[model samples]
Target: MAGTAGSGSSPLSAGGDGDDSLYPIAVLIDELRNEDVQLRLNSIKKLSTIALALGVERTRTELLPFLTDTIYDEDEVLLALAEQLGNFTGLVGGPDFAHCLLDSVRLLAVEACVSIAQLLSQDDVEVLVMPTLRQAAEDKSWRVRYMVADKFSELQKAVGPKITLNDLIPAFQNLLKDCEAEVRAAAAHKVKELCENLPSEDRETIIMNQILPYIKELVSDTNQHVKTALASVIMGLSTILGKENTIEHLLPLFLAQLKDECPEVRLNIISNLDCVNEVIGIRQLSQSLLPAIVELAEDAKWRVRLAIIEYMPLLAGQLGMEFFDEKLNSLCMAWLVDHVYAIREAATNNLMKLVQKFGTEWAQNTIVPKVLVMANDPNYLHRMTTLFCINALSEACGREITTKQMLPIVLKMAGDQVANVRFNVAKSLQKIGPLLDTDALQGEVKLVLQKLGQDEDMDVKYFAQEAISVLALA
Candidate 1:
């Protein structure tokens, strides 16, 4: 186990004498037999370094057999071998050697194939790796096919154009149509990157013709997670496919995804609407996309509504004034009174985003009146929503508008019988207090805060005390 096997002058001769050369080899061979798993793994890592140091001829003759023999070892040992085996690809004699190492471990372990694919060159990939990976694509183990699918880009880059079209395309088709949903999902995820890396001519002719159909099938994949993965990369496909082709070929698939049973698929499409809008154009999106978004804004699941609320500013920014005013404004107002406290809080907090995007005049003329009505609503939650909006909007709406117009509603809310309403009033004062210019307005804010500080609810009093401290610091 410890003997050196090479015939030519050893590369180790550059560093030291015979014993020094054999010492590392002896230690690694002995450690490989060590019962401790970690010791064996560490020995494998050191073996890679030694193989590189030994150069191609010595590694092929002296190191490869010991490395290859470990393929039948326990799972942990095989994983370690898989991770380190790539380091020897350059040191091996040729593709034949790389193939033997990879082919032996691949069926037994997934990481081995992945590492070999990543480490080998374009020529070796086509000659040696392709056959093994193609076999892996049809392997009963979904995980084995998943490893092949995950390495699709690395394999394609290795083989380049000629082999990719002839060999890899068929392999990819098989992977995309694999019986395992996970394998198909993994293959679908790489389709965008694969198309992007190819020349435009090839992307259109080979990828669009061969790969795009599989991608479209994945959008309707029975597995929700698979569809979600497809949703994540759909926008990238739109860019590669170009606008007309995206609309004609891919857009129907994208639009159909909006109705996907999976909330994540729907949410992902909404989140990426800006990117989709760029390719599809805002006006074009208005017909189908906007209605779908608006429908999701009122989705039965609050999480869906929450996602739309989170994305409201981007929607407003992208849709611009006319569209925001017509569609999104009412949605924001509805969220303000949403049955869920968290949704209402988020809608209230995002008020300033609308103000920031649309300007102070828009806030003064359009938004303030609606907020004033909410402040006086019979529902204490609506009144609480108003206080939160005032707190967030004061800085954006400026000192004059806040002190004159918004401060009175906050003052009224300070005396609200609902502790939550009064607590929000106290918090709102902290933001508005600093904006008061005149002594009269400043004293009014101070009086309201002091009243709240003495209120019965401890949470309300605590917030009032915090608000007073904030104003004092200002």
Candidate 2:
């Protein structure tokens, strides 16, 4: 056989794409020995890939010593070298490496946690990670605290049943009070994750003991980012705590947020409560959050209302038909004719869910005729909204209404002037296709089908073909 190795070529270069084993590993390892900081940094990155790909023992013996020397290097390249080296060490040693690096990884874990948080992976979280992270949580640097939480996402998986709340809670409780808003937010999120994996019995205690007292401060956090993080943390708590606990402990805080001065904070708060009634099994939400949801339905800022609208169905479902009858009909009706096309679209989408729950008489007599008039509106988006409403209505109550009443408009829209509008029509048609008996409306329906099947836009054509198949029209 020919000689296995190439002469005078580094393994990485000679390995064909520089990845083969034949290349000289010694040459690259020597680059790490160079005094020039940039070259040393470059060698560090290449070595990290090798260490991760090769083995930790080799990396420990080789790559780790450089980190101690470069740990305080002010050059960004050297700082980066220190960071990846920590990640490599984190991966190899899991929690076990904490003793070896001592304050080196500890200091790095605290100082660069957020910026480098993403680098920590599941393998790094073994029993060793928590003790190290718990220590870093007390660092003077709040970023370390924040990064500790960001890295907590990995720990959520790695944390074993053997680990106790006592082991985890101390670190999170300490960080929750950190002066830095980002640190507090991150800490709140970690507590949320911790409760998620905890047995349900302990969830309430953890939230009460670890997460709740901080709520007022978090809600009132001057920083928008902190408020946002708290809002998410609150939602995470609800998932693990069960609906009843959510209602008693969390709902009030969420409700108060509806009136918050910051639109984003208000949006985050009320948005959580938007569909919460169903999740929590409480009719009070209909009585309480309904007004906020409806008010947000037509909010001046489109995004805020849109967030509320996305969750409207769950709220409506929780509230039930009687609730809409008593509280929501008027509000949804008012939004049906709102000036903004998106508001109208959202209003109509929610209204369609109502028709599904309530019955066709309510939709056909109360909602359909109004939507039909809007379907012919001059603004294309309004027309599209009208089409969206029709499709939703058909899915909800189309079986009850005569196809002649619904199909004429749907068929017309499948060939609308705008490509996107036509696409929506195709999607709506795809959904309703199974309910349609193609032979029933042969002439007019076939024309729409033909256009969709041959639509100039490839995406439109693809969906149209699917819609046709779903209808058995092909």
lDDT of 2 by residue, 320-383 (tens): 6666567666767667666777777778778877776778887777778777777677778778
TM-score of 1: 0.86
Give per-residue CA lDDT, model 1, range 1-474, as digits (tens).
222323223334333455565667666666666667787778877866777666676677545655554434565666566667655566666545666566435454344555565556677766666676667667776766787788778767766777777877888888888888888888878878878777666678776678888888888888887888888888777777777887788778878888787999988888888877888888887776788888888998998889889999998898898888987798898899999988998898778898999999999988888988887799987887888788888899999899889888888777777999888888887777777875844577788888888988999989989988877832
Task: Give me the candidate number with maximum TM-score.
Answer: 1
TM-score of each: 0.86, 0.64
- Name model 1 segments beyond 4 Å from true: 1-24, 30-39, 49-56, 73-76, 89-125
| C-alpha RMSD for every candidate | 4.7, 9.9
What is the TM-score (0 to 1) of candidate 2?
0.64
Model-by-model lDDT, in order?
A: 0.76, 0.62
